[model samples]
Structures are given as C-alpha cells and as structure tokens.
Target: MSKFIPLSVPNLKGNELKYVTKAVETEWVSTGGPYVNDFEKNVAEYVKAKGAVSCQNGTSGLHIALLLCGVTRDDEVIVPTLTFIAAVNPVRYIGAEPIFMDCDDSLTMDADKLDEFCREECILIDGKLISHKTNKHIKVVLVVHVFGNMADMERIMQIAKQYNLIVVEDATEAIGTYYTKGKYNGKFAGTIGTIGVFSFNGNKIITTGGGGMIVSEDKELLKKAKHLTTQAKSDELYYTHDEIGYNYRMTNLQAALGLAQLEQLEGFIKTKEENYNLYRNKIQEIKGLTILDFRADIRSNHWFYALHCDENYPLSRDEIIRYLALKGIQSRPIWGLINDQEPYIGSQVYKIEKAKYFWERVVNIPCSTNLTKKDALYVIECLKNAV
Candidate 1:
C-alpha cells in the first residue's frame, strides 16, 4: 500500500534483457542493426499492415506521416483538441496548421463534428477541400485513438472519402486494439487509415524505453518513410542526400527491447483488460464515480482507465487527483485542450465543447498491465473513502 500506483508503466517481464544483451554482445546498439528490421516486420505482421517503418518516437513517426500524406504549409489538417499534444504537434512540424475538432463520448475525435466541418465549414475546389476561414487546402484528418479507444473511423473514413482528406491514424495508445464487429472487422487501430502510428514509450502499455513505428498499406509511402527516417540517403555508399530528411531511425537497443515487448504485447493486453474490469466493477459501487467504458465493439488495450468525477462526487477532478496522490495512487486529469495551449493559442477551432466537458471531469487512474488485483482494490478503496 505504501508503494505508488503509477497511472501507466511498462510491463517488461518478457525477453527484454535477453534481446538487449544479444544486441549489445553483437555490437549493433545504434540505429543500423538487424533488430530494427525484425522489429519493423514483426510489428507490421502483428498489426496486419503491409509494412512498418521504425522511428525514434511517435512524434517523429507522425512528422514522417504528415510528409508522406503531402501536407504542406498551405494545408490544414483536422485534429482532435482532446488528445495529448504530441498528436497535433506534427502538423505544425510540417508548417501546416491544424483545425482543432471536439471529442465524442469515447474521448476520440467526434466524427459527426468532423463531417459537419467538412460539409459546412469548407468548400470543395478542384478535388480539394479548402477551409473557408483560412482558405488553406484541408488535406488530411489526423485521428488519435485516444487512450486505446478506437476512434469513430467508420464514419471518419466516410467523411474523409467524401471530402478527399487523407486519414492519419495516431494509434500510439492503441497498438493491440481492433474492431470486433464493423466494416473494419479484424483491422487494427493503426492499420485502418492511410497511415498509422504507434508508440513504445516508457509509460505506454509496452515499452522500448522510447521508440515508434509507422505502418501503412501503401508500399511506396512505407518505402519513402523508411528513406526519410534514415536521412533520405539515395546512395548510402556516397552519403548522397536527395531530399531533406530526419535522423529519426530507432536504435537497435530500443528495437531489441521493443521486440521483447512486442512478444508479450497480447499478454499485456489481457492483463490490462482484467485489471480494467476489476477497477470498473469496484469503482462503480462507489457513488458519484464511474469508470468510463471503452467501446464494446472493439477489443481495446484499455491502456489507461478514466475515472469520471461527476458534480456530485466528493471531490473535483483535480481534487481527486490530489487525494489519490496523498493515498500514493498516481492519477492525472485528461490533457488540457491542445488549442488552448500556448503554442497553439491562436489556432482555429471548431466546436470544442465536449473536449472541455471531458477535460474538466475525467481523471486517468492507474491501469498498468503490471497492476495487480490488490493494487486495484487499494485504488478503489481510496476513491470509495475519498469523501
């Protein structure tokens, strides 16, 4: 009970040490190594994508995705304001602006609002959707699968197709998530869009210390992504750079760790699902508090469980977070709306109502794969007596 219950942390009880030790013994610790290639292939195969490109991190993978999607300075991308800032930062990284959208109940981008924006806020030119406010070409829709809850991709994809917008899935928190029933049956989170991205951060469901992967059905884009992440060397022998590129390739050591993590990903997801249900059932018995549910149609990773503090709750969202901290339970509020952040203060936003609603009431509770039933019971007891 004295040990802090982290909100989310890596479950590395797999072959992490062995694989990393092998990589170190072989002296292929840097970016260029067999582990990197194997990791990419294994991830793509797991997610059922045609291919995947490993990168330094999710943000870098997104930067490469935006470029591959042809988002330029003259373009605008539709994004959710409710997600982590990293999901929207890549738009700015490419010099393209983001048109912030609101969130639905699932905490993902509102497909209804997105469709409304494209249908009413923008005008279609010669095969291009241009924003009426800025007159920039609305080229892509950057959808984040928030907290491993799959976005409304079925509707979002329809909206994208009707408006000719490229769909980029930020599936960083949704690596093992997939639809059980729908048009996307059997399609993984990151594999549903034109390009999908996944993260392996220290605090994610799995960890590679730090790294990401880009998956796509498009072979050419995958090839170019690998090229761009590797510094666009047309000829490595001569060190010729054909285009501007990034030093975003993942290190072999990270991949070695990732391969091990990937091996146990499904097992981690099972543990997450079990722990999530335990927290949900126990927390539901506490008045004025409820654990938010992931969409039933999809098998989610349940990466981070959301504890909603209704007005009748004994403490406000921030207050509950503080109380949990005092109880040695780590909990945090959902991210501040990205549009309101200093870096994106003046950015365009479309009906950011629900995002604010969720932001004010939702607290992310501990749901790490390694969390045991005893730890979950302790967390629930703290919430039950928080009053």
Candidate 2:
C-alpha cells in the first residue's frame, strides 16, 4: 500500500504536453502570448461570464478584485471562518479587515445568518454597513462556494444590494457550480457577483502548474483587473506606472496548460460527480458516517467528498484521518477556524455557530478526477472496515 490516495490532483491527460511544447517552440514562454488571451476567453465562455483575466494565482486575483471593489484600510469584508485562509487573506492584503461569519449546512456562507448579522450588529452610517466593535465600514461580503456546492447567492445578493455593499465571490473551488432554481437560475458561480476568482493549482480539477483567473460582468472592472495584474502599466512598451500594482500575470506556458485543461473541464466534472455518487451510496448505509449532500436546486460538480461524523461515528474526524493515514489513504480535516487563528484573533466575527461545529467534525476524503472505479471501491472498502 502506498500513502498516496491523494485528496485531489491535476489531470494532464488532455493536450497539456502538445500545447506546452508548442509554447516553448514559439518562444512565448513568458507572461505575454496568444495562449494567455485564449485561455482567458475559454474560461469566460465556459462560465458564461462577460470577461475574464488570468493572474499568477487565486490569491492575487482576489486581491485585485478587492482593490477594484474599493476595499480600503477602514473597511470590513465578511468571510467564512471555515474556509481556506487564501480566501480571506486578500481582505487583509487590501489593508481591510475580515469579519468571519458562520457557514450553513451546505458548508457555504450562512445566508440566513447574514441578514441577522446586519440587522443586529450593523448600523447604517451615511449608507455604509458599519460595525461598532471594530469601527470599520463593512464594504464587501466575500462568499465562498465551499467544495463546489453553490452558495445561497440569491439571498446574499439581495442583502448586499440593500446594505450598499459589494459582493465578491471566492469560487476558487466551484467553477462549474451554479444556481438552478433561484433568482439567478442560469447563473454560474463566478459570474453572478461583482467579481469572482478561480484557482488552477496542482490539486485543483485542472491546472496551469499554478495560476488563476478573475472575472466580472462589467467591462471596466475586468479592464482594471487586467491592468492591475500586469503591474498597472499605463504604457505597454515604455512601462510607465501610476498606482501601486502586482506582478500577478500568468505566464504563456501556464496559459497553454490551462487551455488544454479547459477542453476537459466538462469530462472532469462528470467523473467527479460519478465518484461522489458511488461514495454516497456506500457511505450512507453506515450510521454516523454520511457523505456530503449537494443542493437539489443546483447541479454540483462535487469537488470534494467530506464526511460528517455523527454520534454513531466510530471515531472523531482526527481519529478517522489517522486511521486512513495508517492504511495508506490521504484524508484531511477542515481548515482551522479563521477567527481562532493567531493572526486574526482580535478581528471581529459574528456568532459563528455552524462553522465552529463543522470545523471539528468534517474530514475530506479522496476525490480526484483520476480516481477509477477500482480506486473508489478500494477507498470504500477501507472506510467500511476502518470503523
């Protein structure tokens, strides 16, 4: 047995080598090239977005989106404490503070709690959502569609519109997910907000070695993101700079890989969903161990398979992770609650009840596109016997 049933990994069985080799042969290995533009176009079309801009990684894309949304030092951005730190770090980068919130049953931002948070603790100061505890103006709500399940975006957007706040979606783990029944019926994850970001890291569904993309419906917003990602250069040849910017551009080589990966996005998503179904049918029979549920209102890509430990569960999440580790399986605990982390200890957070509950009990199992039926059965057999 090898200790390498990974939680996630890139699929390079498509046109990766051919395109990357072509880029190398053409001497377009650096940031500027045709593939970069083409990759952006493919993603924008895939997600049904107005436009897209590629960047160095998801974090930089998020920072640029925050800048475009006017997030400043005195501003507060609402975020989920249960999400990966990368989703919230951009709020701090803009000199803005993060106000950690709770998650719902879907493990996404708690939409119901959001309105309650605003009604109880927030005050409208000259048309701003102001927090009395931190004395910061809450300017944006950064909602994450955790593990590819669609967040309750329709309600969240309505709340944003009423509160005079911008909604920035961190759909890094949920590129293909979208609403199926709500006001945003046909909208894709990243396409519904003021701005959205996606990742192409090694462990994502697809990869460009390492890169990201940002999208927005507004042409001006997309333009600003494109300019800022390339160091905010006003002049291309002379390279004159005005405002502070980031060297967050993705290379042509990476874009070439992304272009190849985009061609398989649909197939990758389909396989992932199929794997999730096998896990669910098997795991559901065992009490205290239940597979995550995708919302019926949305068609999920099932990016990750997280098991919730009920009272009858044979072990705690940590115990299960250790058991799987001993059996040469790779599983993971959810991110440590952000509000509980050392750096954000003093930051303001709403009553994050659900997020706190989930942080301790969730264990993410192997869910990769490359997982074969044999591999899935192997995992299920181990899980059934482990308990």
Candidate 3:
C-alpha cells in the first residue's frame, strides 16, 4: 500500500523535540513554567497583538473571551454556520445561545448578511441590540476565519460598531493570516476584533498537540482573560477567590511544543501557500471542480484547501472522499451547518443561503505544510482520475 496523504497534519520538524525534552528534564511539564510565558510572548509578537494569554485549548480560550465580553444567559452570539462546532460551543459554555449566520464565496462569514440581520431582525434599545425572534440581547459576533479565509472584517466591524456588538474572532484555523489592504491592512486575523482566539490543535497551521491563545489590543481585557483562565485568584500567596474561574491554562509541555512550532510558523505558511498555488494551477482546468482561494487582499496562511464540486462533477462529495481514502489519500467534506446540528436546532438562523451551498459542495483536500510538490501532484492526479 502507498503512504497516506492526510487532509492536514502537524509538521513538527523544528525544535519541538529539543524544547519538549528540556521541559521534561526541568520537571516543568505541568501548567506552570517559563516555556508557557515564553510561548505566549512569542505568539503575541508574531501576531502583532498587544498581549496574549495561553489556554488549555481554543474552546477554553473562546469561553473565557466570551466571558470577558460579558455574555450571560439569554444573550446571543452571532456565529458562522460553516465552521467547526467548537467555534459555536463556547457560546453555550457561557450560557449564551448562538445565532447562526451564512458564509460568502470565500467561505467566511458574510458581513452583508450580518448587517442586514442586525438592521431588520433586531432593534437597539437603550444602547443594547435585542433580537426580535427570542428577544435575547445580542452581545458578540463570533467570527471564525474559516480555512484561513478571513471574513469581511471592515464591513463586519462597521456593523458591529454601529450596533454596539463585541467582535470575538475565532481564529482557530487562521493563525498567520493577515490583511494586506483596507482599514486593517497588515492586521492579523485574531487581533483585529474585540478579542481573538487561536487554536494550536494537531490539525491547525501550528500545533501544540492541543492548546490555544487569546489576544487583544486592550490590555485590560487581555489581563482579565489571563485572570479568568488562571482560576480567578485575586491573591497568589493567599489564593483568595474573587469569582468563579476555570483551569484552562496551557501546560508547559504544550507550550514547549508550541514555542518550537511558532518559530517555524512563517516557513510553514510559505510552504502551505506554495502548495496551495500548485494545487490551484494543477486543478483549475479540471472540469466540475474548483479550488477555492483566500481573500486577494490578504496574506493568508493557506491552511485547509477546499475543493468546490458542482453538479458537473462525476462523483458526489462523499464519494470523492471515499475514493481518496481508497487511494491512500484523505479528504473530507465541510462541516455540517451549525444551525442544523441537534443541539442548535432550536437556535435562530438568518437567511442561511451560501453556507448550505458551500456545505454540500466543498471538500477539503490534502494541505499539510510538509506536503511535497510530488504529494500535491499525486493528490491532484488521483482526484482528477476519481472524478
């Protein structure tokens, strides 16, 4: 049997072993260590954020970020329907419901639809935007940068500002992506909103095995996020509890791996971009399928590459995935629309047009940073033959 080309996997060829070994030798494998602080510092500098706080995982970071945003029971957070369930689960963790929104061509949240929803389906009362359907206070817009493709943050931010909504960018899949044009030119994905969270899960651009980081321009909010994630202890020596908190701090071992991954992030991104372009060039002429691109105005990390299969395709999305698996290649369809999920069936969804379209058509292909040119070509050839 031939070697399997995975959909996405960790590329840990950097100093991962050395750092992790050192952490183990120093007996700092737990949540507290110098590597943890160093990892946070390196990530903050890389993403150009004022501060970053390390957490157990992206979901926890999101939970704390939403908490800091003051999301309470009966509050609604606007979220994209075309993302991993983890992006929306944090809203429920805070006792808040999610209002699922659709995606645009780029597979990110549609800022136009968001604006329309706010203007027509909601009303501002005493400086608070209340949803007409459930009468819940709409507090945050949880925008996930799907597959490293950024949403229209400029327009989204404008609508959010006009409606007094806090924007929480769920950048779990977009660590190195940044805009190159417009109001947030040179701004990273997770740093532009009210607060942003990045995941370093095994499948992400960079992996800490399982970890996440929270970033914000506001120092106070960043500090508060740190506090909440660290058990909300008002006094370190006395261990005085100010309020409820969570043990969401990232472990030193995870930070050790993360620090090494951070060092090679730019290089990994370059490789991902090159491979994506290779896939684009090779697959563009294929009938019945199209490889999606990142936003033109941004230098995206080019994380996961989605192949949009139209009706002209010879096989369905699931069929293609199965074929790829038989050929020792891994592929997957996009996430099921969040609104349709069993837990969120009762939640509100606004004119979910494009999200459902993309969900049915989009198939993620092999896009690991270490994927060689030959591997990419093989994937393209196999996919073409399968169709």
User: TM-score of each candidate?
Assistant: 0.99, 0.98, 0.98
lDDT of 1: 0.92
lDDT of 1 by residue, 85-128 (tens): 99999899889999999999999999999989888999999999
Candidate 2 positional error at 143, Å: 0.4
Which lDDT values do the candidates have, in the order given? 0.92, 0.89, 0.92
- In model 3, the Cα lDDT at residue 363 comes to 93
For residues 1-387, could you state the per-residue lDDT of candidate 2 as single tens digits?
654687788889999999999999999999988999999999999999999999999999899999999999878899999898999998888788998889999999998889999888889989998887776799999999899998898899999998988999998888888778868888898888899999998888888989999999999999999888888899878989988878999999999999999999889999999999999999898778888798889977788888888779788888999988888778999899989989899888888898888888899999989988888888788878966
Q: Candidate 2: worst 10 consecutive residues by lDDT?
A: 1-10
Clashes of 2: 0
- Per-candidate clashes, comma-separated: 0, 0, 0
Residue-by-residue lDDT tens digits, candidate 3, 1-387: 768988889998999999999999999999899999999999999989999999999999999999999999878899999899999898888788899898899999998899999999999999999999888899999999999989899999999999999999999999999999999999999998989999999999999999999999999998899889999999989999899989999999999999999999999999999998898988888898889988999999999999988988898888988888998998999999989999999788999999888888889999998899999999899878875
Distance (Å) between predicted and true CA of 218, model 2? 0.4
